[model samples]
Target chain A: MKVTGAVKTGQRPRGIETSKDGKFVYVAVGDDDTIEIIDAATLQVAGKLPSGEDPEQFAIDSGDKYLYVANENSALLTIIDLATRQKVGQVAVGIEPEGVAISPDARIVVCTSETTSMAHFIDVEGRKVVGNLLLGARPRSAAFKADGSELWVTSEVGGGLSIVDPAARKTKQVVKFAIPGLRGEEIQPVGINLTHDGKLGFVHLGPANRVAVVDGISHEVLKYLLVGQRVWHGAFTPDEKYLLVANGASNDISVIDVAAQKVIKSIQVGEMPWGIAIAPTRDR
Target chain B: MRLGIVVLCVAVGWCGVSFGEPSQQLKIGYMWMKPSKIRVSLLDVPADNDGLAGAQLAIDDNATTGQFLNLGFDLVDREVSKGEDPTEAVKELADEGVGMIVTSLDAERLLAVASAAMAHGQLILNAVAIDERLRAEDCRGNVIHVAPSRTMLSDGLTQYLTWKNWKRWLLVVGSHDNDKLFADALRRSAAKFGAKIVDEREFKDTGGARRTDSGIVEVQRQMPLLTQGAPEHDVVVAADESEVFAGYLPFRTFVPRPVVGSAGLVPGTWNAAFDQWGAVQLQNRFVIKFHRPMSTLDMQVWTAVRMVGEASVRTGSADVAKLVDYIKSPEFSVAAFKGQKLTLRDWDMQLRQPILLFDGRNTVSVSPQHGYLHQYSSLDTLGTDRPSSKCKLN
Candidate 1:
């Protein structure tokens, strides 16, 4: 209902992820080329870790041992050791790497490249790209299923959602979106989020100004919930009651009631709000 | 005929694979007709590979996506020097099994290549020719235009001018075929947008040296005289695509009015200062790769290549027939950092996109302006609509 607080991180902050314990929020400051650590309790920048050029999106390992950042401009993945908060190693992926996702088992990490239009799979132990699966044009974000059996990647320009099989390293199904009156080009799928129970999935259609709710099992678009202009990213509240989306052009975050599947309120944020990360309450 | 045979032989040698290879490779040929010399101010010289560089970058992008799908993409760049027949370049690319070719040439040469390539059932993407007739009476089914037409550009500028309440325009046209065509587009735009052309004049290109030791003094003296004696007008619209005098009229006009069209505050597909809708990332990537800021030509060629890339990926094949069919189909669209996906117009095959009005420093506005709307799309507001199209593509 209200913006708890807002903090200025750096120019063009793109991707955000909260720590497992919800103590720190990692914000990818793209132009700054660094991951700024925001202390959840104080809502202040605690520390920063150097990343590759134009880090856009990142995901931490299930064990919370390492953090993987997708360097969009450099086309490389920078791996940071969470304990020391230092760069441990780097893996060459593809051109314009924008999305990073770690599997539930923490054995594999998927990096989606926008220009490359491929999901490069990295072996966590070896820290090397083991394989790649071609995707549609301008793949923006990737999300893993609850069981990690499948990975859903949103292609912004392709205007579709590619559901990939992790074991086979191939796309099993592609779910395309179309509105009756809107042209196909207007429905650009960008940010994606899957429910913990894997029953529902939310895909942000960038210029379409709607978030598509798909039935996870059938992969059918259940509803097109209207949001704001050029929505980019989404994060779930700690209690799983609400899904908050950062609408980049509108400069606000649209709050969706999870049970009702409708936008309840739009919380105003800073200029061009791109990414969001919700911290778990201490009571949890 | 001999050049065509030699080109065919070279093409057959390069692509040794049979027609039905399991892993299909899509080879796109970029054919450029290089002008022997261009007249421009000392600071405005163009890069040697202006359009080709953008194609190269898009090639890299295509290959990145193609590698996973077993669809390999290759770019064969051929430059036709001045005085050489551009048709030979198109024939050579066609013989080499290139079903798609991106070209950056003037209208006349582009028409020759387009007609020649169409015979072989090949598709051509016109990346930098702004001639409106190409999409109108001279339209060919084989050619798809990525560049914005003169009508589109003029209408974009006129829309912004009308929104700003600058109603009266003094039109100055250069004495060249292309210049006159552009002037016609401006005239049409002024009439459609409820603006008045108070006066019109032609600046004769008196053939002489474009550059001299004391050229500045001469240009400064002649520019004011060239623009003098016009009726009261709010702005001066110069159609000098020939680059003969429009650049000199910006600050040197007789009445101190803002100049537009071919120079100052020109309407284009892309600009270096345009950063909206995540274009800054594209600009940064282009600069990092090429070591220079992206230009309008670069953006046009990039979009052309990206169109081919999108079609190939969506169809999951490198077959030219399939790619062409997909592109012409209602489903095809490509995103070029323009806040929307650009689609091909079924009637003329011109890519429908928003035009950026740049003032040489920053983006002033984008057209398909706020108030201008169409039943189908706002993009239709800029250029020749379906009702006005004389193009009977066959």
Candidate 2:
């Protein structure tokens, strides 16, 4: 709705997430192979953390004890200890690993590899990969269900969404998308979001310029909300009233009214925006 | 620290279970002729591993994905020496049990090799030789074209020029036969795109020292004299495949008109300056491995190798017939960081992709420009469409 101060990080900053208290924001600077920590109060880069080769996406655990980063070039999921600011463990998954999601219980972590087209399940406590489930080609993002019962992974090139049973380590179902005029290759599913109640899902269709609203329980397509070009990722507001999507090519963010399922505003942003994270509101 | 135990678990069997089947070896052949011609500019010189390096990179890319599929890829590159028979070299590759081949051969040699490979049920991916007839009158069922055709390149450039309202062109032709052929393509494209060639001239090759230390001063003086006295035109289009004069036409033109064709704002499948559509990642990988920028031939060969990898992944087999069948099918599409999936035309077996119009330092724009529409794909507007194709693949 309005302009805000911006902080410049290293080249090609991709994934961003806030700490539990929202005091610091960790960003995976992909080209720099490091994470830039931005202090919330100052809105400036405070420090840097050692990330593995070409870190694309990372997830912070619920307990705020550890950070799981998907090293895209190294094919390893690097675990970093928050308190000590040290590399704690590494689990070899698949090639071009990206799209990290830590389960609600903080016991399981899902790492999706782009080239290998597999979602690897890691035992956070054991510091090892427990299971692997192959999905569509070029898997880009992973999101766990509200209760951590299922995992949804977006396959950018495969143009589908895969729902996996984390406990059984099997793909339970796959939801495919199709638009009337667009070709199959244009329907690439990139970033996925699920409602807190687990009743609705929003799948970002890259290049197709539309966000698919799905019936989360039945996994059926509800409607397609038209948005900006090359939508990469999205984030829900702290109140869940709006969903803000970063359009990479358009260099803008489209704000959609979650309840109405329509675009309400388009806020201009920097060039080729990839990821978005909304921190909780603080008292003045 | 539990690093040792956790690493051992993954190293031994924990993560290994994710891979399916035992690794099956997929061997591919890369046949190329050593670059024989010297360029006018040192920057235009071809590297020793020009085409082969791209195939090697693709092999590594394939192996990365192959690791999860329990597949292993190996590239066996063979350089054909002077007076060596390319057909025999292809047979040698077949003897080594390599059924898929990516080649950077001339049109004649490629046809002979394709004929020889047909007996062994091998598929040939043509990574060089942009002769339009190869995709038209000389089309073969076993040969798939990765490089853009001459007409495609001409059309790509012409579309952009037309979009800019530069309809009048002063066409310059070189004396060599290859240059003449490219000039024909430019003429065809100009006619198809409704652009008029206001004037045409030929620069005869008189056999002189054009690459000397003082050649720049001579070219700068001679270019303006040569380009002068032409009819009214918005651009100068030079077709000089022999590298005789096109490079000199830019910035030295008499009328200060922009240049296009083999010179300024050239149309190509890939350019060193192109970094959009996830191409920077590829460029970084290539530069890190080869210590050089990826050339157009390298990108074409890379696309060819990646096509084979994609087919194998989709069909789940290394059988030559299966791979060829899947690649020729309509459902087959391979991504080469081109912003879209490239598919083969059923009639010509030419890969459909957007051509980048690039200068020496930057990619100015991509062709198949907006407002150029087609019933099926806008990419069809670049070259011979399905209805007008002379190819009838068996």
Candidate 3:
């Protein structure tokens, strides 16, 4: 079955978030600062709710009942009720919020802004920016460990993944990628992935077209993998035996055998598959 | 409890995985279409090194401002044999310190090659594959394409068709299966371009011989009857990829309508008769390479390789990641075959390139006229759009 459905809000919709039960997909339409909801089964667009100003990215709260969208131009985070797809509250963040991540408490949100080069730690309950810590240049994507200990943020301009400790509101480690080969410049990461075991972390190195697999604890580059032209996202199969990589440049998706660390087969799909989220979480 | 603690520790501290610092190598590898020994037809007909011999070409032409300083313009080539494992080859290239790879293969091989590249932080460059699926559903971070997508090419053809007001077509297909597939693509293109297929005809493969006994008389007798009265049509599009009777079409048509498809205005990456702006230089270089003319395959590969050289020079850093970024960004454009600079699409990794609408003798008009509108660019005007698109890259 195709995981297909899109909700066009005001304009320029970029990112999406799915409810835990897989019933709805919340689309972040940046220009209008609106979150549109769609029914996953019927591919029907349902309702539209207010996001903050110029929302860029959003994340799901731990309970899966609240959605937090990071609004860039307005420097705020809009919290919404999952069931109603309605805005419940908004918190002031640092300037130019780009990525959002919900804390383990389900009552706090962490946002990264490009202009300020810092992450604003917010208390969800009070709708306030509780803390601010500087990061790198143009932080774009963010992810959290399964257990929610540390948050990973990718700095597109800085060409690295910045690890932020949520509890302490501090920067942990910065993992950078290689500069471009033929096209010069640093490789800016767009997406982040972690093995089911959570021992391995992979960063989607854009234009670099590789995945930086790092050892989470030691912060070492375990391997740099060439996936495809503009490699974007990857997801593990239910058994965790295969890792499927979306090769943006070539119009193919590679099925990687995890144990062998080799590509078994490449299935051709529709044009340019971008972001991915694997359902029914599996274990190692 | 101890085992759980160890697992937690491993997960918590897994970030310490590095192969030391990177060396300055503009590392690039090749992922060819055919896995075994193969041949690619060139528009320059038998050019060497894809027809760059006479051109003032430099492997390090892209090198600029003291970058790729460790190893300038490192291009490693590996022929992809059908049975040979592409991933293993990618790993081998990585071992040789190649940071990026370029391929002229289908979407299937592109992704396989990409996985291998990812295993070693190597990037893959898709130079020839034009399947739209790769751009939409299979877009990869480590892999970026440098070739015009099939959609782009089709769209190019459709625009000219639309402009020509070739409102009606008699789509004729050869006996070969691939011919039918090409016809299918034409059908899609026709619908997209607002053209109508009055009727579809299939020419069967009889034998090597065309019933030669009294055949000339019979051909004169039947040729007119076969075509003259085909409903209502403005063009007879033949998909005779197998070198069938479509070649005898144009004048032989009963109705005397224009013939297109493979026999008429063909859409392709490059054509030998083309001598646009930089084409003459490219053609000359290719001729010098093989003592003959350039072929479509030769020209495409040559263009793909040259693109790497150009991006390297422009980016001023030969780092594999940086080079890929430059190519992926809208900022990086290459002056290629269709008399314009092309870039990658934001929605799809498909290269937004100009398609040469050729008639085998001379160049026709390039599809993306200046005024075409698209969110990305007029180049996107070639293939399926978001509305008619079936691809959902999730």
Candidate No. with top DockQ: 1
Per-residue lDDT tens digits for candidate 1, residues B1-394, read 6466445534543111112223778899898865434655655567887888899888877776665566778899999777898988888888899999999888888899988997888899999888888998999999999998889999999999999999999999999988999999999999999999999888999974567777889888888998899889999999998888888888999989999998898999998889976688788878988998887888899889888987998889888999999999998878788766688899999999999998889999998787686778888998999999989999
For residue A107, model 3's alpha carbon misses the true position, in angstroms, by 70
- What DockQ does candidate 2 score? 0.35
Candidate 2 C-alpha lDDT tens digits along B106-200? 99999999899989999999999899889988999999999989988999999999999999999999999999999999999999999999999
Error of 1 at B357 (Å): 1.8
Ranking 2 against 3 by TM-score, winner = 2
**Per-model RMSD to reference:** 6.4, 3.5, 20.6
Q: What is the TM-score of each candidate against the true structure?
A: 0.90, 0.92, 0.48
Candidate 3 yields a Cα-based lDDT of 0.64
Q: Rank the candidates by DockQ, best first.
A: 1, 2, 3
lDDT scores for all predictions? 0.85, 0.86, 0.64
Rank order by lDDT, top first?
2, 1, 3
Model 1 earns a TM-score of 0.90
lDDT of 2: 0.86
Off by over 4 Å in 3: A1-284, B1-25, B33-71, B138-141, B175-177, B205-229, B241-245, B369-371, B386-394
Candidate 1 accuracy as lDDT? 0.85
